[model samples]
Target: MAERRMMLRDPGLQPERTRLAWSRTAFSLTLFGLLCFRGWCRDGNLFYGVSALISGVALTAMLAGWHQRHGKQFLSLSLWSVGALLLLNSLRQVLA
Candidate 1:
């Protein structure tokens, strides 16, 4: 069986702050994706547009999972995945 990673009760204010920070990161990713999309539209580059769209979806999912109180493992996975996606997207835009 998979190891359980959830707590039975609230872990205090630190977790709340971390959760809020995750939401903020999600919001920032959404905004950055939009900006990238706009630039893609202007430049007629499919790569930029597609990467941004993926980032938006990833971040949105993270935010949703977070608010629903998904287990810490799930939250960590989603956050890291979104962060990596955004990082790769940024790198591709810069290097291409």
Candidate 2:
């Protein structure tokens, strides 16, 4: 008798694509945070400064845990947070 390796038949490419999305989301959030930080450092108040800092931290944590989460929840949360950051960043600019 010979031992054989077992693998999922499809091993679908969806996982890879989903991971890429997470990576992209993380990158976008981090980039936004850095840009906002720089911008706010000049005329930005404490509110913006703290918000930007927190966003950066969140982005880092998201990237570090990206591969350590379940598919549905991970994707949903990452995307929602990304959208939130974008909204907040834009709102800061508009209100200023």
Best TM-score goes to which candidate?
A: 2
TM-score of each: 0.55, 0.57
TM-score of 2: 0.57
Position 62, candidate 2: lDDT:
75
Question: Model 1, residue 96: displacement in angstroms?
Answer: 9.2
lDDT of candidate 2 over 44-70, digit per residue (tens): 555556657666666766767744654
CA lDDT, every model vs. true structure: 0.68, 0.66
Q: Pick the candidate with the highest lDDT.
A: 1
In candidate 2, where is summed lDDT lowest over 10 consecutive residues?
1-10
Q: Tens digits of per-residue lDDT for model 1 on 1-96?
A: 234544444568878898788778777777877876886889876666765766666666676674456545654564466457557867987999
Question: Once model 2 is optimally superposed onto the true structure by TM-score, how far is the C-alpha of residue 82 displaced, in angstroms?
Answer: 9.3
Off by over 4 Å in 2: 1-10, 70-96
In model 2, pairs of residues that clash are none
TM-score of structure candidate 1: 0.55
